[model samples]
Target: MHLSEQEPSSWPQWLSVYHKRALLGGGLLLATALLWPTPQLTTGQRIALPLDLSSTSTHFSVPDTLEALADKPAFSTTITTGDTLSKLFERAGVDQQTMYKVLEADLNILALDTLQPGNEISFYLDENHQLMRLEIDFSLARQVVFTQVDGSYDVEEIQKKGQWQPKAVSGDIYGSFYTSASKAGLTAGQIQRIETILKEKINFARDLQAGASFSVALSEQYIEGVASGDSQLLAIHINNRGKQIDAYQFSDGQYYDANGESLVRAFLRTPLAKTYRLTSNYNGKRRHPVTGRIAPHNGTDFSTPIGTQVIAPGDGVVTLVTDHRYAGKYIVIDHGNQYVTRYLHLSKTMVRKGQRVTRGQPIALTGNTGRTTGPHLHYEFHINGRPVNAMTAKIPMASRLNKAELKRFKSMVSQRNIQMGV
Candidate 1:
């Protein structure tokens, strides 16, 4: 052993150092395997690793997803029941001051009293934080609706019309005429005629019984596919317990009792039935009653009590309504191109020029307002403006009924009468 104790050879010393390094490397590899985890989150939601950790920070690529989230849209509101303009603005999150500005911009826009339910309104903000469109629906009468567009409020009117569809309605009258007519699909025009026809015979509100029944043929008018009012009545049959009636619309304006004759007369027998006298008869050319001079006395003079109605002489158009020293209030009518008539000495003129006057239409009231000693109606008739006696002037009879038309008319009449139980 003493023989070489030779300086612990340098080669052996180097080999010993290399073995120690190999052992340290093996320990580090084992530690790393237990420390790191695979990436689980997307790029947009990536997490940062601590400096003490072996792995670097990583992320997933997700630009498309983030962009979609930022592009979501906003919405506004529409009008609903029991809502007012103030309430509507509040729901849209618009300020009161802004609403005032919008209203000021358009004077014809929505008003407080005209708002209607179920109308749409929109809201949005512009880049400058200002509102753009403001609108209110004004298409319908007595209604208002507001809307917004392009960051402003705009209003448009919605027109609602009653649908005009043919229908058959029948019901019993328990109370008033309106109640009964409403059940029968009868419109205002038809209801008016029904009252006119029955007013002389019965008082609907007082006389209608629970058993009284009515059948109506009529149409209804609708706006925006919504029924609003009733149209004209085509035909009607009313059964009032024992009283029965069938009426048809005639060209003369109202329904008839199976006959074409008008229910209204061309004239009343006298202006006042209680106290009236024929002061002067109609004459083409005669001595004037007041002046006692030869002149054209073209009208009949009826001395009547004050306030007596001076009715129309016939169906005509009012051509003149005037007041003169001699005729305080007077009306002239053109029956046609050939026939004309006049009424004079009135306290009040009930008609105007260019008005259509029906037979028995009240043109004025009697009074001693004109050149007269008493209240009277100075009536006159003329053919082509030449004065004639009104009392003796005979109206041409209506044209004869067409044979074919008459036959059809009679058939309809018979069927209606049977239905009416007449």
Candidate 2:
């Protein structure tokens, strides 16, 4: 969506665009003046050279805006470890107001927030030192550019269906699955994802014996021969003794076995292993006791001790870990596939932002940190960006693919199997 900036505030942004081009348009006058091949004259000197517009062999052309931009001081920065948007903008000499403006413009998109340590961002400023354009390169395959339009910013999201280069890594279990996978050129994150996906099928520590082998068929995205950040597992084959196990990732972002059965990895129904008393249920129609308003209870309240352990219900990336005035210390986790989980009124957080967590992993301790009557854990589950009842709502669970999808999956598997030399 394109937002219009207030007419009054639009001057600074469009100044860089219209004014610069206007200055270039003035270059025609200079070009016309250069037609006189006589000796160089000062400002007071007037050379009466008869210029015929009909047959002047010299061509007059205005300079491009890029040529004008060459004279402006350029701003660029690469996101690094421990770098925040504010910190990077500060380093680039941008004020807080401008940063907020950029963020406000990107409220509906997933650009600014998804930037990692390796991503790149640059700012283009006008003569008044105002941000005219901002470009964020997530990878070689994707980019987001914000241009100053009128008074607001225009957002452009660029995505490329990059070429997927299949890679097969096979090796015998050495010391551990992690070590062997690392030796076979798989990243730690990749190995962890595979373990999480096949967790229900095999216990890497206990199931594998001597002479066990593992084969991973994955694909890495690349654009113009440059690798992008889209490595994903496609199919895996593990042979332990006489038992053979295999799983394939279908197009629906779920894994299944050779028989089209789901390698189902569902979130734990509850974050706590040991059940505590349920103090409150998800009541969307409940009224606030103090505020005397129809403030719906969107989360589940579990009455627990101050130091009760809280575990992650699903595999996800920690998106937020902080304190709130009314909610206390809370942690928000983003599980992919439009699933998210939130834990509020926490005493301690075990994971930080950007950290990957698996199902049943300890993530925090329950406590009353916010506006609460007592110590308890408030949990919320979200699907498609809205809070739902954690106690009843269906979490991410894929049982099996449909007939048409299964046919497509078979074709994908056949192609991948040949690629991996299975």
Candidate 3:
């Protein structure tokens, strides 16, 4: 008998064998897929899962490590023209005590008080919803952070000297300097600063004439190809009736002419008429007389009788006149060009906030108001918010540059002039 005739009944058994092998292979594949472990997501990695909108129970969840950050409380706001630090803190739900602590930390740096329009500030809260960190972005290149350390806050500033792109604008004095400068793309603030810099030499309201030419040299700061809106005034020039007045910025941050003569009035080195005995000098590691611990004495102390007149060291606007537990009654004068003077331990403050005082004007009276042993005066000179030894640190008494300094300044001025297209 042939094999084709004999296999007719055995066809079902052969077919069963093929079916069983197919089923076994399918089972192995399904088992392997179901038994495999899912790889975990690394730090900063995220998983995006498609959602079925029609389903009710289906949901997405973040990793456990990221939950804390996602749940943490945070607040941020941009400072406006009338924005204040206290009000901003209140909106962030921070208590006044914490705000005061931040202010106290700002005593040395004074960064918080200098908040300007368009600056951003943020506060981060911990698990307990208490402020843990605060950040202020002053500009694209400047940032300040305050972090809670123990019972106080530690301040750290991150600043970058970004590339500055030079800019120049020139115009004819049509009506007023302010109008002409504004037409030439100078801001109101910039115009005001220029007027202030050249106030001693040229009076824009009185000396500037119509049809006279004026030019400004400024720099627009850039960070990573982004405009920071920070315009630096490099130089200013005005030609009126054939008389030329120039003010060029120098490395010392003061403005001067090509001859290295200061553009502003001189600062009075001794604010008082008569000399007083020096009781304590500025010491970074001085032992505190009250606490008996290592503390930094940021200002010089002079022993004077009560009611001794305290005069302003320079022409400036009084920014603060307030009382403090440790500092007592103090007056802060903000002299133009990054200079500041403080009179502390005063029994009385003669000037009010926002009052402009002359170089020799009375500002306060010395006394033992604070935690001091006797009647004395605590005077401090600050440059860019950091206190220096006024007794030894270089004071700007309308400084006339020396030979070497003048040469360097003239060279710098020439370069700036070319950049300004003058």
Which one is best on lDDT?
A: 3
TM-score of 3: 0.72
Model 3 pairs whose backbones collide? none
Q: How accurate is candidate 3 locally (lDDT)?
A: 0.72
**Per-residue error (Å), model 3, residue 164:** 2.0
In angstroms, give how far residue 126 of model 3 lies from its true place. Answer: 2.3
In the order shown, what is each candidate's alpha-carbon RMSD? 32.2, 13.6, 17.4
Give all candidates' CA lDDT scores: 0.52, 0.71, 0.72
TM-score of each predicted structure versus truth:
0.33, 0.60, 0.72
Model 3 C-alpha lDDT per residue in residues 304-337, reported as the tens digit of each score = 9999999988787788888765567888887867
From the highest lDDT down, the ranking of the candidates is: 3, 2, 1
lDDT of 1 by residue, 254-320 (tens): 3455555433334433333344578888654566556564534656788777788777756667867
> Which ranges in model 2 have alpha carbons more than 4 Å from their true place?
1-67, 70-73, 81-84, 106-115, 149-156, 266-314, 317-396, 401-415
- Candidate 2's displacement at residue 41, Å, is 43
Best-fitting candidate, scored by TM-score: 3
> Using alpha carbons, what is the TM-score of model 2?
0.60
Worst 10 residues of 2 by lDDT: 40-49
